[model samples]
Target: MSAAAGTGAKRPARRGIVLALALAALVVAVFVGANAHLVYVAVTSQPDCVPHAKEVGIDGAPLRAARSAC
Candidate 1:
Protein backbone atom coordinates (compact mmCIF):
# COMPACT_ATOMS: atom_id res chain seq x y z
CA MET A 1 0.00 0.00 0.00
CA SER A 2 1.12 3.58 -0.62
CA ALA A 3 2.28 5.74 2.39
CA ALA A 4 -0.75 8.06 1.84
CA ALA A 5 -3.12 5.16 2.49
CA GLY A 6 -1.28 3.80 5.51
CA THR A 7 -2.21 6.61 7.91
CA GLY A 8 -5.63 6.40 9.64
CA ALA A 9 -5.58 9.63 11.70
CA LYS A 10 -8.62 11.83 11.27
CA ARG A 11 -8.48 15.49 10.25
CA PRO A 12 -8.91 18.10 12.98
CA ALA A 13 -12.43 19.47 13.56
CA ARG A 14 -13.19 23.12 12.57
CA ARG A 15 -16.08 23.79 15.00
CA GLY A 16 -13.80 25.49 17.53
CA ILE A 17 -12.26 27.74 14.88
CA VAL A 18 -15.67 28.81 13.57
CA LEU A 19 -16.93 29.53 17.12
CA ALA A 20 -13.91 31.66 17.91
CA LEU A 21 -14.32 33.70 14.74
CA ALA A 22 -17.99 34.30 15.55
CA LEU A 23 -17.12 35.55 19.03
CA ALA A 24 -14.44 37.91 17.69
CA ALA A 25 -16.86 39.34 15.14
CA LEU A 26 -19.47 39.89 17.84
CA VAL A 27 -16.99 41.83 20.03
CA VAL A 28 -15.93 44.04 17.12
CA ALA A 29 -19.53 44.79 16.18
CA VAL A 30 -20.36 45.84 19.73
CA PHE A 31 -17.32 48.10 19.97
CA VAL A 32 -18.06 49.84 16.68
CA GLY A 33 -21.74 50.25 17.55
CA ALA A 34 -20.92 51.85 20.90
CA ASN A 35 -18.51 54.33 19.33
CA ALA A 36 -21.05 55.27 16.66
CA HIS A 37 -23.67 55.94 19.34
CA LEU A 38 -21.26 58.13 21.31
CA VAL A 39 -20.46 60.16 18.20
CA TYR A 40 -24.14 60.60 17.44
CA VAL A 41 -24.85 61.87 20.96
CA ALA A 42 -21.93 64.28 20.85
CA VAL A 43 -23.07 65.72 17.55
CA THR A 44 -26.75 65.99 18.46
CA SER A 45 -26.48 67.45 21.97
CA GLN A 46 -25.62 71.20 22.09
CA PRO A 47 -26.01 72.77 25.52
CA ASP A 48 -25.46 76.51 25.88
CA CYS A 49 -22.13 77.46 27.40
CA VAL A 50 -22.45 78.18 31.10
CA PRO A 51 -20.48 80.34 33.53
CA HIS A 52 -17.32 79.03 35.15
CA ALA A 53 -15.38 80.17 38.19
CA LYS A 54 -13.30 83.19 37.18
CA GLU A 55 -10.75 82.63 39.98
CA VAL A 56 -8.03 80.06 39.83
CA GLY A 57 -8.15 77.08 42.12
CA ILE A 58 -5.72 76.45 45.01
CA ASP A 59 -3.55 74.73 42.41
CA GLY A 60 -3.46 78.02 40.46
CA ALA A 61 -5.42 76.61 37.54
CA PRO A 62 -8.92 77.25 36.28
CA LEU A 63 -11.37 74.54 37.24
CA ARG A 64 -12.18 74.28 33.60
CA ALA A 65 -11.80 76.58 30.64
CA ALA A 66 -14.98 78.47 29.74
CA ARG A 67 -15.88 77.81 26.14
CA SER A 68 -17.26 81.39 25.91
CA ALA A 69 -17.63 84.32 28.35
CA CYS A 70 -21.37 83.42 28.66
Candidate 2:
Protein backbone atom coordinates (compact mmCIF):
# COMPACT_ATOMS: atom_id res chain seq x y z
CA MET A 1 0.00 0.00 0.00
CA SER A 2 2.53 2.62 1.15
CA ALA A 3 5.10 1.25 -1.28
CA ALA A 4 2.63 1.58 -4.13
CA ALA A 5 1.83 5.14 -3.11
CA GLY A 6 5.52 5.97 -2.98
CA THR A 7 6.03 4.58 -6.45
CA GLY A 8 3.06 6.55 -7.78
CA ALA A 9 4.46 9.79 -6.34
CA LYS A 10 7.84 9.11 -7.92
CA ARG A 11 6.22 8.75 -11.34
CA PRO A 12 4.83 12.31 -11.37
CA ALA A 13 8.14 13.71 -10.17
CA ARG A 14 9.98 11.86 -12.87
CA ARG A 15 7.49 13.10 -15.43
CA GLY A 16 7.98 16.67 -14.29
CA ILE A 17 11.74 16.34 -14.65
CA VAL A 18 11.35 14.89 -18.11
CA LEU A 19 8.97 17.65 -19.14
CA ALA A 20 11.37 20.33 -17.96
CA LEU A 21 14.26 18.72 -19.78
CA ALA A 22 12.23 18.47 -22.98
CA LEU A 23 11.29 22.17 -22.75
CA ALA A 24 14.92 23.13 -22.23
CA ALA A 25 15.97 21.06 -25.21
CA LEU A 26 13.32 22.74 -27.37
CA VAL A 27 14.56 26.20 -26.44
CA VAL A 28 18.15 25.22 -27.15
CA ALA A 29 17.18 23.79 -30.53
CA VAL A 30 15.38 26.99 -31.53
CA PHE A 31 18.32 29.15 -30.51
CA VAL A 32 20.79 26.99 -32.39
CA GLY A 33 18.59 26.90 -35.48
CA ALA A 34 18.20 30.66 -35.63
CA ASN A 35 21.93 31.21 -35.21
CA ALA A 36 22.64 28.65 -37.89
CA HIS A 37 20.36 30.54 -40.29
CA LEU A 38 22.13 33.80 -39.53
CA VAL A 39 25.52 32.19 -40.16
CA TYR A 40 24.28 30.78 -43.45
CA VAL A 41 23.11 34.20 -44.57
CA ALA A 42 26.37 35.81 -43.58
CA VAL A 43 28.38 33.23 -45.49
CA THR A 44 26.33 33.29 -48.71
CA SER A 45 25.27 36.92 -49.07
CA GLN A 46 27.34 39.63 -50.75
CA PRO A 47 26.70 43.36 -51.03
CA ASP A 48 27.74 45.86 -53.68
CA CYS A 49 30.11 48.58 -52.53
CA VAL A 50 28.25 51.83 -52.93
CA PRO A 51 29.88 55.19 -52.74
CA HIS A 52 30.83 56.20 -49.22
CA ALA A 53 33.07 58.64 -47.47
CA LYS A 54 36.65 57.37 -47.60
CA GLU A 55 38.39 60.26 -45.90
CA VAL A 56 41.91 59.68 -44.75
CA GLY A 57 44.62 61.80 -43.07
CA ILE A 58 42.14 62.67 -40.40
CA ASP A 59 42.97 62.21 -36.74
CA GLY A 60 40.61 60.09 -34.59
CA ALA A 61 37.64 60.55 -36.92
CA PRO A 62 35.63 57.59 -38.10
CA LEU A 63 34.81 57.08 -41.77
CA ARG A 64 32.62 54.66 -43.68
CA ALA A 65 34.32 52.15 -45.96
CA ALA A 66 33.26 49.27 -48.17
CA ARG A 67 35.04 46.45 -49.94
CA SER A 68 35.63 46.90 -53.66
CA ALA A 69 33.58 43.85 -54.62
CA CYS A 70 31.04 45.36 -56.95
Candidate 3:
Protein backbone atom coordinates (compact mmCIF):
# COMPACT_ATOMS: atom_id res chain seq x y z
CA MET A 1 0.00 0.00 0.00
CA SER A 2 2.82 2.42 0.92
CA ALA A 3 4.64 1.63 -2.35
CA ALA A 4 1.51 2.33 -4.37
CA ALA A 5 0.98 5.61 -2.53
CA GLY A 6 4.59 6.67 -3.19
CA THR A 7 4.15 6.09 -6.91
CA GLY A 8 0.92 8.10 -6.86
CA ALA A 9 2.70 11.01 -5.11
CA LYS A 10 5.31 11.14 -7.93
CA ARG A 11 2.62 11.61 -10.59
CA PRO A 12 2.04 15.24 -9.67
CA ALA A 13 5.79 15.90 -9.65
CA ARG A 14 6.04 14.42 -13.15
CA ARG A 15 3.18 16.62 -14.30
CA GLY A 16 4.90 19.68 -12.88
CA ILE A 17 8.09 18.86 -14.76
CA VAL A 18 6.14 18.40 -18.00
CA LEU A 19 4.35 21.70 -17.45
CA ALA A 20 7.66 23.51 -16.85
CA LEU A 21 9.14 22.05 -20.04
CA ALA A 22 6.09 23.11 -22.06
CA LEU A 23 6.28 26.64 -20.68
CA ALA A 24 9.97 26.85 -21.53
CA ALA A 25 9.28 25.67 -25.07
CA LEU A 26 6.57 28.32 -25.41
CA VAL A 27 8.98 31.06 -24.31
CA VAL A 28 11.62 29.88 -26.76
CA ALA A 29 9.09 29.86 -29.61
CA VAL A 30 8.09 33.44 -28.84
CA PHE A 31 11.68 34.61 -28.77
CA VAL A 32 12.44 32.92 -32.07
CA GLY A 33 9.32 34.34 -33.69
CA ALA A 34 10.12 37.86 -32.53
CA ASN A 35 13.68 37.64 -33.79
CA ALA A 36 12.46 36.36 -37.15
CA HIS A 37 10.03 39.25 -37.43
CA LEU A 38 12.76 41.76 -36.64
CA VAL A 39 15.06 40.22 -39.23
CA TYR A 40 12.32 40.24 -41.84
CA VAL A 41 11.56 43.87 -41.20
CA ALA A 42 15.21 44.84 -41.31
CA VAL A 43 15.88 43.02 -44.54
CA THR A 44 12.70 43.97 -46.41
CA SER A 45 12.41 47.64 -45.49
CA GLN A 46 15.90 48.91 -46.35
CA PRO A 47 17.95 49.63 -49.46
CA ASP A 48 20.91 49.59 -47.13
CA CYS A 49 21.08 48.80 -43.44
CA VAL A 50 23.59 51.64 -43.22
CA PRO A 51 21.91 55.04 -43.37
CA HIS A 52 23.05 57.92 -45.66
CA ALA A 53 25.93 60.11 -44.52
CA LYS A 54 23.65 63.14 -44.29
CA GLU A 55 21.26 61.19 -42.14
CA VAL A 56 24.12 60.12 -39.86
CA GLY A 57 25.44 63.69 -39.51
CA ILE A 58 23.84 66.96 -38.41
CA ASP A 59 24.58 70.24 -40.25
CA GLY A 60 27.85 68.90 -41.83
CA ALA A 61 29.27 67.85 -38.44
CA PRO A 62 29.86 64.23 -37.60
CA LEU A 63 27.25 63.45 -34.98
CA ARG A 64 29.13 60.97 -32.87
CA ALA A 65 32.48 62.86 -32.97
CA ALA A 66 30.80 66.14 -31.96
CA ARG A 67 28.43 64.71 -29.36
CA SER A 68 28.74 62.00 -26.74
CA ALA A 69 26.74 58.85 -27.41
CA CYS A 70 23.84 59.03 -25.02
- When superposed on Cα atoms, how far off is each prediction in RMSD? 6.2, 4.3, 7.3
Model 2 alpha-carbon drift over 4 Å, by segment: 52-67
Top-lDDT candidate index = 2
List lDDT for all candidates, in order: 0.73, 0.82, 0.77
Residue 64 lDDT in candidate 2: 50
Please, what are the lDDT tens digits per residue for candidate 2 over residues 1-70? 9999999999999999999999999999999999999999999988766755556435544665544553
1 against 2, candidate with superior lDDT: 2
lDDT string, candidate 3, 18-63, tens digits = 9999999999999999999999999887443433344456657565
Clashes of 1: 0
TM-score of 1: 0.54
Clashing pairs in 1: none
What does the lDDT read for residue 65 in candidate 2?
51
From the highest TM-score down, the ranking of the candidates is 2, 3, 1
